[model samples]
Target chain A: MSSAPVHAPASNDVIATIRDKALWIRRRSFQMVYEAQLGHPGGDFSAADILATLFFGVLRYDPERPDDPGRDRFVMSKGHCTGAFYSVLAAAGFFSESELSTYMQPLSRLNGHPNRNYLAGVETNTGPLGHGLPVATGIAIAGQIDAAGFRTFVLTGDGELQEGSNWEAALTAGHRRLENLTLIIDRNRLQQGARTEETASLDPLDDKWRAFGWQVEVVDGHDHAQLLEVLSASPRGRGRPLCVIANTFKGKGVSFMHDNVAWHHGVPNKEQYEQAMAELV
Target chain B: MSAAVSVESGFFDCRDSFASTIEALAAADERIVTVVSDSVGSSKLNGFRSKFPERMVNVGIAEQTLVAVGAGLANGGKVPFVSAASCFITGRALEQVKADIVYTNVNVKLIGQSSGVAYGELGPTHHSIEDMAWLRLLNNLTLIVPADPWQTEHAIRAAAAIDGPVFVRVSRMPVPALEHAGAFEVGKAEVLFEGDDAAIIANGTMVHRALAAAKSLAGEGIRARVVNMATVNPLDEAAILSAARTGAIVTVEEHSVRGGLGGAVAEVVTAHDPVPMRIMGFPGFLPTGSAEWLMEHFGLTAAAIADAVRQTISRKR
Candidate 1:
């Protein structure tokens, strides 16, 4: 179930639609991971709301014209967490919802990581950490050079910032004043096995972006209203790239897995799956 | 016989050819963009930066971002040439090169400047002798190691025309302009000279020296054929198999003896038609010396190649 992609201040209707999609995303993504017995469900659930907000409301893309030069771009930098990504993409009509069953199966296009060549809405191939932002920066630079109307957005994991490549790209994007680009850091605290603060701290992250010449905005990542408000805002005359620090929990929807690092790479057991699905709403 | 050995038809650095060709390409194609890592001066792109200031995207000395940005530019439909010191681009930011450019299958042109031991006295830290070995592993990536200025120009143009990832290894080392009547193709090996006794397959800065080696070998009554194989990833199998027909193959390059042009040639010759092969190049991290001195010290000269070809011929079945 997909809403018409919108770009206005979040009305109650739009917020409800995003919340519905987000819940669906959380439920469907976990189901895929549970069936496959493979995926970063913690990261996926953490990023589900953001992905739902983007695909259903903020991002302007025609699933039929996925390769349209003028279409807005969303690069999932935290690519290992494809449970949420593939769900949002399917819901947005990039592919059929039934195809989720083939995810991570033999010869499936729905791979553990996203590949642009194989998947319609996937902008670039990403699995290795810290790769998405630089690529997004390059796309933004390309848009700026052409004076194109399409904006570029990238959602990166908090721990993924440990990679220096992101900062390298951040410097370039900020220096170029690429106002058309928006970087959304999924500040969910937990990484794979430990909290990001414990595993190479990334606090004072907003200050770091500011020093790199980016405008910073902190928001409740799961708040459809907050995500829509910041993301849909105009970049006109902004003169700089925007960095949205989306504060969230690792496993946002499920009670037992919420903010839990052990669930980062673990799949749900049959009973756990049913319980999580029940809690998703 | 020493570091003083010179190219027959005057000397030229392929980096000059690379710069001029990109400038010419950018003039015609509006989508052509250059992404460098504060390497405008090193890559000899000052003229290009001056002409098309906006098109020259200097990512400020970050090799990883330099390569990834090129991939992005390609995503944005601009043909981006990601240029940087060969050692850093291929080694320091290798994952980005693999994930962003190759695995992503983008049309990003990676111009690896001063490849091999062109850094000379700067030591192994800056030497990119392992680039071919590393890059040749990635599929869907066009690997071109131009022999001289002309081939360097042709390779750059060809890489631009192709709609995928390409790594054009350029050298600051002086080499002569080669004479060729046929057009340059991406995967075809150019037979500079033909002989039935033995073959010397070479590329990059070593092609000219291979020709010189072939000349001296002829005087000594040894007719050694010379094949300039610039494309490493998709080796010219037909040409290499034909060279293997000579019974003895001497693969020479301005790279590591383990896995560069020499190693690539051996792969074909061994699998299809086993032959006595002598892979000639540097051993590993070289001693402090000038570019020419190191080439001489490592036996990457015409005399050494000819000697190796002669030695390889003795083991012919």
Candidate 2:
């Protein structure tokens, strides 16, 4: 069932509305992971604000007409963070928020990763890293061919960029001058096993993207004002795609979980869950 | 549909049919965009490029992006036809094929050119002998190896018509186009020649050889049936079972016997109709040689196939 209109709230109150929505997303993500006993809560929290802002304030999508040809396209490349993705979609009126309870249940569409066929708003199914950007580049190219003014956005985990496929697509996107595409990197330092730097450093990540011909932007991911401003802007490069590095904290809003490597995909126990909910409140 | 110039000659490159058919289809449907991995010359897609420059995209030596981008294009409502060499397209970007194309179930066409030993003497590094085995394991993907130009053109058209992920293989090596009765349909096999003594099941370049072997077997009073299995996945189990009734089978392919046509036939036969079978293919890696030399070296000739059929039939008795 539809939740609410996806249009941005009054301009002055947009940030506050998105901030409250981000908190709700975090709570819903925690409950989903807690009930399912499975999911990457850390990643979900890290991307909560970015997802909430995109769904609520920036993205040009109609929940009632999910398949509208001229609507904006979004690909959640950081598929492990599907809890946050699903929660935001639920809040955006794609489906009922109550479905979150069925998060990792048998045969549930809310899988460990986002699947386009299973959900209305998911642009493509992605679990493996480095896939979404290339697909987004292709989508942007299609828009260019059809002269379709719709923009394409893809969210990728910082660590996921380590996959060579992302660079391959980046090189092509830059060469094609895909002005209609925007790639958002969820720059939460932590990965599944360790910090991203410890696993495989992506430091100077913006420089790397710039070298590949992308118009790079580094933004405070949790700031709703900053997110809405950066995301709503038109393509910056004359002929190149845009890359927005969204610096965020893992397990955000949860005191014990934030930036803690142990919380990567860790499901909190009963006491930990209550404490997380308390912190979110 | 009758712009067709039939070639009933000595040998015809299947890539010719592939390029011509794709160009014609692209002319009709703007959704049919061609993406290549620096393989326009080898894939014989230059004409299509010249005609539809806007639709031709070259990812330049990157097979991973070739498929990933194709998946994305499909996501945006365009039917992408990815043309690349089989060895790199299937080996280098295998995960993209699995995750982006197959797992997502997008409408992308993967045309693997110069498959098998078509890149002759280029050594094992370029041989796509493992393509069938590797691609077969992935779900929601259709695998087709067109034996000649007629079949190749029809297969390309069939793949374009289908709505999901499809892999069509074409070879640089030319072979006489075989005349078959019905139109080419996905997951369907055609009986080229019929006999009761034994069945010679083959695909790709080996179909012609299998037909010649059946003729040789008939000369010796040992009649052999010949079946051309163009589609490997969603195999025509009914035709396979019917061939099994012969009590003997000789499977031939230009791939490793472990998981190509032979492996598929064996799996089906043993489960429903167990019979004496001989799988003929490159048992292992071979020294660099010409395509003809390598085919003969691996016992892929009609004479060798006939000998194997004789052995298989003898074992059945």
Candidate 3:
């Protein structure tokens, strides 16, 4: 594992400090994608801040003990955004940061999808949508079964919600009253082909979740402090699951890619990559 | 029909045997858990649910979640058996079966109930003729298709005892008990009958058909060997080779002709010693009919299988 970065706090004090680190991860992730000339950069950029906050501020995990039974679990249901996940894991001291350059290279452990067999810190292999929620539910149920205090969190995309498996898990989790399970939807409206609204609208999303028996919380996903507050709070209603519907841009930090449909899986050219990096700095 | 002396006991659905065996296993071990997709009553698992409510997780009407959740439960150190209709379990949740259970090498038992044309009236949507092919493509998965009630019980026990992923295809169609009272093994093929002219190998519900076909061949002075190959993945290469040495081999199954028991046996025979062979199965999508009618239509009946074997034997000379 590589040494963790030592950094000076930013001017905005608490929020900017976390935002700066998140921006750094986003920049590095973009560089890897650009270098490899392949990756879902839009989703990664959209999800970077949440990843940074969870790994650095909220999640109760020890990098040294990835398999600690008592540690809280995180599942990346939108596994195409693994560029963001790998960058955060590297920053959190799970592996060498230099290894991020190997992102889609031949025979690289970092394949198109995150595989648990070759990497630590990956809870499960999830490229296909709607798989993470059920697995996360199982983790939460396991904690309840063992009488452990560990919590389980899963992040999914807005369009991925079209998959019916998520609703199945949602119903079961709420019915079981698994207070330890938290679902964080990175509600970046754009999907691979087009905007989620144009494809299959998942609006009334929060109400749908609430109706399915979850305590729904809507928040700005990019706001580090708000994310931390909502994430750290207790499960809202008794005998129900928690759903944090974090409203997010398809591409958050990069000026050119932000809210741009074409950037859903677009790799930046050299000049474009440089421009994005400069904005981050 | 009078009870045949060859069949030990009366007819019974293997799903019953599976549930009873699983209930016994769960009682002995606290780690054993059952996950169903609203199929508790259909799979004959109501007794299991009543006995161990905590261990029974019924993710109603969601096959994908059922399978992925079973993988997660396995990851949590519980040996989970995910039970569902074979068509839905194997077809709908194929990616989960491949990624979560097989690729991840999780200790989850995927119990595919009512396989083949068991749901006759429900039409092609419910028929699971392609499950064997789909499951066989996955690596590190032990595929066991039990022939009868006794075999089903033994398969469940063996799967629970094994420490990795296993897929047991249980049938809702009634079958006479074929195996002796206490003789069952996982990867070993049982030689039910010995002959020198030709060999008939079968699996799942077709094992009895192969046996009957061999008995029919005996009347014509054409001796046919019968091998019950319950395990499809780790095929009994020795038995297959021995059968190939007899100059002709015939494979019978309730699955599609492609990538099933027939395909598995063909792969083995072709590699070891190329021989004249006849593969019997549903060649394509079958029309809706009664289970028995569908079996006969697909040439899965004993007489049809014997005729095919005889044709292959004649082709050898």
- After superposition, candidate 2 runs with Cα above 4 Å error: A1-10, B1-9
Question: What's the count of clashing pairs in each model shown?
Answer: 0, 1, 0
Q: Rank the candidates by lDDT, best first.
A: 1, 2, 3
User: Whole-model Cα lDDT per candidate?
Assistant: 0.91, 0.88, 0.85
Q: Which ten residues in a row have the lowest lDDT in candidate 2 chain A?
A: A1-10
lDDT of 3 at B22: 91
lDDT for each residue of candidate 2 in B1-317, tens digit (9 for 90 to 100) = 21333434567778888888998898899889999988999988889989999998898888999998899888778999999999898999999999889988899999999999987798888988889988988757899998888899898999999999999988877688687968888899999998999999999999999999999889879889999999998789999999999999999998888888899999999898599999998876768999889999889999999999989988995
RMSD (Cα, Å) for all candidates, in order, is: 2.8, 2.2, 3.8
Q: Can you tell me which runs of candidate 1 are displaced by over 4 Å?
A: A1-7, B1-9
True lDDT of residue A123, candidate 2: 85
Tens digits of lDDT, candidate 3, A79-131? 99878999998888788999999998999998888888888788888898988
**RMSD score of candidate 3 (Å):** 3.8
The two-chain DockQ for each candidate, comma-separated, is 0.91, 0.78, 0.56
Q: Pull out the clashing pairs in model 3.
A: none
TM-score of each: 0.97, 0.96, 0.93
Q: Tell me, by lDDT, which candidate is best.
A: 1
lDDT of 1 by residue, A1-281 (tens): 24344555577787888899999999999999999999999999899999989988788898999988989999999999999999999989999999999989999999999999999999999999999999999999999999999999999999999998899898899999999999999999988778888889988999999999999999999898889989988898999999999999998878899988889998889999999988877
**Model 2 per-residue lDDT at B155:** 89
Q: Give the candidate order by descending DockQ.
A: 1, 2, 3
